[model samples]
Target chain A: MPTIWVYAEIDNGKLDPSSLELATKARELGDVEAVVLGPGATEAAARLGEYGAEIVYASDDQVYADYVAQPHVHALTELIGENAPDMILFAMNYDSRDIAGRLSARLGSTLMSNVLEIESVERAKTAIIGGTIIVDVALEGAPKILLARAKSFVAEPLEGGEATVVPVETTVPEEAKRAKRVERHEEAATGPKLEDAPVVLSGGRGLQGPDNFKHLEDLASAIGNTAVGATRAVVDAGWVPYSYQIGQTGKTVKPSVYIAFGVSGATQHIVGMKGAKRIIAINKDEEAPIFQISDLGVVGDALKIIPQLIEEVKSRKG
Target chain B: MNIAVCVKHIPDPNVPPQMDGKYLKREGIQGVLDPGDEFGVEAGLLLKEAHGGEVTLVSMGPAAAQEAIRRGLSMGADKGVLVTDDTLKGADALVTARVLAAAIKKAGQFDLVVAGVESTDGYTGTMPGSLAELLDLPQVTFAKTIEVTDGTVKVNRQTAEGYHVVECSLPALLTVTAGVNEPRYASFKGIMAAKKKPVETWSVADLGLAGEDVAIKQDVAGQTPAEERKAGEVITDDGSAAKRIADFLQEAKVI
Candidate 1:
């Protein structure tokens, strides 16, 4: 079987769910193994094993105990040299992209980023030119690096299967330790994460003002498990934080249910959330292009419609 | 306190391109500097203002890429370098990174190398990290705010979770995201001054690279226009849009 190695990022003793999804997808391609890095790699192995990893290379080294790119790149470079895996999959994240890109340069190999689908060991597909075209690319090299887009695969557990965990033994060079993480300013997030939330409620310029976003917050709270998002127009207008922006320049989200309120759905906005399983757009303009891609298009004033929708949803929940 | 900013020339993002069968047709499309790279230019200029150093713009593309260098010059960059050769026609991300690393090294010592998180056209988002590794420099990717002090650089990096403050010694690399700073428009005076600014053109040979060293590693097997989503169910407002939406949500089983 072709050996596939997945780079799993661990934080606070937990394996990122997106990495598990990558591991789950790797099973179909070949015999899958996971290489977890950082302080909690050892603790994360068991969880990764449950997601169909055949082997887990857990590195609980102090050199990588913090968030830095060079050390991880050095560790992965050594692992690729030792294992000679045919392909390595990295979950699309900051650290994974950093390490994968660096390792590809070190090894003179091909690194494919934002891959949407994998056709085979040799060929993969990614969106290019601002999501206007899909290109099937064949990478010619050993240890092909694929950075799978986040949420491209579902994390399916393989019950009753356990992976053999092996501690990774590698030394981080002195030069690799130059960069240090000083502090992390974590956002005071209380609700579901935009990417993790199954239901997303996003507002646009039609919401009128920043204060009007409170209605979206009410609807989201009423829905219980929804994350609030915003369009570029609203974000540019200073109605929302950059973190709340969803578009070509913002967060790319693929929720199970996406509700767009007052969003005219520019191509920039649509490219970010088009992967929603069910897209529901609420727009006052019936001629809006958002209705073209929406699974359910509701033509009405959001101000008049959202309050009633919230009441209806609350009553249903009651 | 010398900095190098990597910029790219791409087809204008505003105009939807006419496809050349399986690839983007570039013959008639106006090529502008990649929008994302403007942030890099702006950051580099800001760094220069703070640290009192020169910002050298670098790019790897066809001869037309000089347009991007001129634009950067017009935006207050000091000098520019263009690396172009026929062999680099289909270069992939890794190859591009290697060539850029070489060009940066050839341009001499730089305290920092700044680039866009990804090019608007390719969107690989990996070249800066690759370039850093090739040059053996510390990298801070997706930085929102960058500060250079006492031979070190600090940045606030954007992440899926939130943000992190990262610090690295000088002679490092940083890839910036959009919204990091407001890019300045090229002024008439600046545009005129750009004509006098020196832009050096180099080939693969100048960087001690050959056709094989920078050959593209990925082959395009085929291409397809992006899949268009169809309007599945469109209903006008009959004073029951909310109820209809609720029922549709229930039927879709997403509630």
Candidate 2:
């Protein structure tokens, strides 16, 4: 069987959900092994095993404590050289992107980012030009790197055997440690993370202003496991933080259900969420491009329909 | 502190890019500076103002890429450098990073290099890290706020849960996210002043590199338009749109 190596990330002594999601996809391609870095990563191996990681290769050293991407690059590159995995997968995050790029340079290999699907064991697909075009990419080398978009694959836990933990030893280059961590300011997440949210309610310039975003928030609250997002229009207008922007230039999300409110389905915005399993678009303009891809299109003013939808959802639960 | 900001010239995303057969058609599309690079340029300028140094703009593209560098120069950068080569077309991110690293090395000593989190066109968000690794410098990315002092750089890097305060020494590389600051519009006087600024143009040979050194390794076997979703049921309500949506949600087993 083809062996796939997943770059697992550890957060607060637990395996990151996105990393586990990568494992979930990696196992489908072949024998799934996880390469985890930093302190406390070994502790998360059991959880990684539950999510389809057959073997956990871990590196926990002082040089990795600072969260620099280079150290992991040094460690993982050595591991990949020792055991030549057919494919390597990573979550599409800051550290993973950095590491993949550097590793690709080191190995003289190809790194494909924002990947949506595994077309086969060798080929994958990604959206280009803000989702207006989808391109199938083929990597020509062993140990090809694939950075999957956030939430592209669901993290499913299976009842299976524990992963055999293997410790890998490597030296961190002095230059990699040049970057240090002084402080960590945690922005208390108000609700479910957008990537993990099962349902996403997004707004755009069609909402008129920032204040209208509250309607989507209320609707999100009504539907548990929901998060709020905005199009680049609202983000550029300074109405919402860039963290909440979902578009070609923003975060690519693949929630189970995506509800676009007052969003005009610009290809820029569509590229981000078009991977959603079910898309529901609400807009007054009947010809909005968003409706073209939506599973359910509602032609009406969102300001009027949102409140009613929230009430209906709440009443149904009651 | 001497700073280098990497910028990209891309076809205006506001205008839909056309496709000639399977490739992106760039002949008629207007090229502009990638929007994300504005924040990088702004951050470099701010660092220069506070620390008292020069901010040099570096870019790799065809002749028209000079337009992007000039825009940065107009935004208060001291000078600009453009790396243009006929053989550099279709170069991937790793190759591009190598070229940029070579250019930065030739530009002389720099305390810091800044870049946008990702280019709107390529959207890989990997160049800065690749460049950092190639240059053997510390790299920090997704900075929401950046402060430089005492030969050190500290940034509040954004995260899924919140943010982290990452610190690195001078001679580091940082990739800033949007919302870090509001980039200023170039004043008329600044625009006129930019015309006289010296912009050094270089070829691949000047960087002491052959075409194969920065050649793209991946092959695009083929590109087809993404599959379109089928026409779905549209409900235009006079007054019952909400009820229909509620029912539809229930029928779809989503509510």
Per-candidate TM-score, chain A: 0.86, 0.83
Query: Proportion of native contacts found in each model?
Result: 0.75, 0.63
- Across A111-204, the per-residue lDDT of candidate 1 in tens digits comes to 8887888877898988765555789998887989998766788889998758899998887878789778878776666699887798999999
lDDT of 1 at B168: 85
Q: Which regions of candidate 1 fall more than 4 Å away from where they truly are?
A: A129-132, A204-209, A231-252, A262-272, A282-292, A297-318, B225-227, B232-255
Model 2: pairs clashing at backbone N, Cα or C within 3 Å: B111-B171
Off by over 4 Å in 2: A28-30, A50-52, A119-122, A154-162, A190-193, A205-211, A223-225, A231-253, A264-271, A283-289, A297-301, A311-318, B232-241
lDDT of 1 by residue, B10-31 (tens): 8886775566665566445688
lDDT of each: 0.84, 0.82
* Model 2 docking category: medium
DockQ of the two-chain complex in candidate 2: 0.52
- Residue B228, candidate 2: how far off, in angstroms? 1.0
**Candidate 1 vs. truth: CA RMSD?**
2.9
The number of the candidate with the highest DockQ is 1
Please give, for residues A1-318, the per-residue lDDT of candidate 2 as tens digits.
999888987655656678888888887788999988877888888788898888999867756667578788888878888899988898877667778877877776777777888866679888776565678776676778888876788888867747999997777777667777667655454798886687888998789988988888888888787889998768767787667878655677787788898999765577679888888888989988788888889898898888888888999978
